[model samples]
Target: MASLTIRQLDKSYPLAKGARNLVLNKIDLTLHSNEFVSIVGASGCGKSTLLSIAAGLEEFDSGEVLVDDQPIQGPGIDRGVVFQSYTLLPWLTARQNIEFALKSAGYAHTERAEIAQQHLELVKLAHAADKWPAELSGGMQQRVAIARALSYRPKILLMDEPFGALDAMTRRQMQQLLLEIWETHRLTVMFVTHDIEEAIYLSDRVVVMKPAEIDQCIDIPIERPRDFSVTHHPDFLNIQSQIFERISQPLEHA
Candidate 1:
């Protein structure tokens, strides 16, 4: 069954002279249960905007977005979002940050601590659970953000370049950790990124978008439990090259 469905979505922003700036146009996408889908495109392609809309953090001008067949009205516990920024509360420890989300989602106060600790360990951050965002590394902070998002057990995880600010090594580590989390939880994920390799490596399908609409939906076809070694494989390189070509093509011709 489809976990998230977006149909003919249209969004626009008002311009200076009362003109409308079209952002997303006639966008349609459907993500099945436990599927990992990534959206990649050039800057100004409305990638983040689409993700925000899915998170119910932004409104659309037309069309419909649904979670399990129910139209999205606004932000809810059903959708969890993580952005490029770590977004952790500076005053809270890693564990407290996740516990905050759990509390807001109506989890029992007594159980929140244990649940938060479990999620921290899920992201391999149990060792740093007591550390504040300032004391932790960038990667660690993002892991905490992810743990907080998942702590509520949202139906879908919406990530907008969640690792964009991390170092290369940390980015790779987070990607591996995310893959493991998705596999373990059987999550339905919608990821947005500018990194082609990251998208291909983590996604079952890549949705290539133009300025306001989807250009193509490319299947990775790579076997799972993937590791760093898969990056050097011939199939991986070929798929990367193809996505690059699509991304580099002119918008009018795309």
Candidate 2:
């Protein structure tokens, strides 16, 4: 399988008095191609930082992160990122926002518009394509942001709490939307979320991270085209309970 491999990953930031705040230490993980992997842990367990390193936005002091056998160095079209806050450019309309990324990637004007529209439709935001970010609802803005990220057709989608700020109902809707997109696109996804149920519902494997290491990778064998109505099914509930138990543990002792 085409995969990502991380070995002995470590990162630390220098504090004011020459002290270093160790964030990640000896962290190792692997994500196969077309896999939906959810990472969950305490707030400061470096889950998001690990994704940053994978996306090449940050560097580790030691260790390796290789995607499909190549070492990651800097940001590239192969990796896409979506953050908690909808990072949309207020001045640009939804279509323009995606188009900007395409253009910056050196795509031609006609191709950029074509690809942007395609991705907007994929996220079900085609109708709001011409609307400015400020004019759209929070959900709509996030849809546009997701469209922009997928517009590049990146190999891996790196998400950091992309649905964290939405209301409960909207969050569920977005989660379903992501699953649908995954079904059709089959993009490798590395998602970071604090929501235990959401993590179990959307991931093929829920990776529980401890204070400075991964505790376990639990495979979710739930059948796809998942019905939200069956979210409380025995099997689903079992997986949810297991995840809840794991998530509730303190990272230091996990």
Candidate 3:
């Protein structure tokens, strides 16, 4: 478990006239140890940008980002990331994919094999350990990607719409599997997605982000061990509506 804190974060890209396109603005957020938080927003709202910065994949223009109160230097072993696209090395088998990540974390050949097998089992992909990425279905490939990400035992996990490319059924299944793993591991997770129900189903709190800043954050009052049935609960729909209202807020006229 770890603490992630971002204070007054800002990020912008250069525009045609040397002006900047502000993508993130004074984004302040914190995830307590073992908390599952999801960031949701309309397209082009900088949700992925914020997540990327936290993963140390991109730099912010200003403000401070810290993990466990320590300033992030760069992409470190302390954080693991999974994205919509399965970023697995194609030539490697499922098990080998995980082993490859462990190797970079400085595990010996023997330990890499052992740890790889263990994580594959954690994601219930042990049966397909030897299958190449091409042989695995979309869901199966994602499982392998998840296994590889977690094999190193990173303190926090950042997922950027990891289930976005999956079909509806597979997306549901993956969400269930992810929640199971999160519960078992007691992890600090920051997930970015455009799906409201998915966020409500998987997150302890859903943070609604505006185009260039956070709009609001709503706590999910539902009980844990969530399932599809939770979607039918009135409270779930109510929270979902609240988030929708925030996301749909119109920008002020210039």
TM-score of each: 0.97, 0.96, 0.98
Residue ranges of candidate 3 with Cα displaced over 4 Å: none
List pairs with backbone clashes in candidate 3.
none
Sliding window of 10 residues with minimal summed lDDT for model 1: 1-10
C-alpha lDDT (0 to 100) for residue 112 of candidate 1: 98
Instruction: Please list the residue runs of candidate 2 whose C-alpha ends up more than 4 Å from where it truly belongs after superposition.
Output: none
Q: Candidate 1 vs candidate 2: which has greater TM-score? A: 1
Global local distance difference test of model 1 = 0.93
The order by descending TM-score is 3, 1, 2
lDDT for each of the candidates? Answer: 0.93, 0.89, 0.93
As a TM-score, model 3 comes out at 0.98
Collision pairs in model 1: none
Put down candidate 2 lDDT per residue, 131-240, tens digits, no spaces: 99999988889989899998877889999999999999999999999999999889889999998888888999999887667878999888887868768889888988
Please give, for residues 166-211, the per-residue lDDT of candidate 3 as tens digits.
9999999999999999999988999999999999999999998888
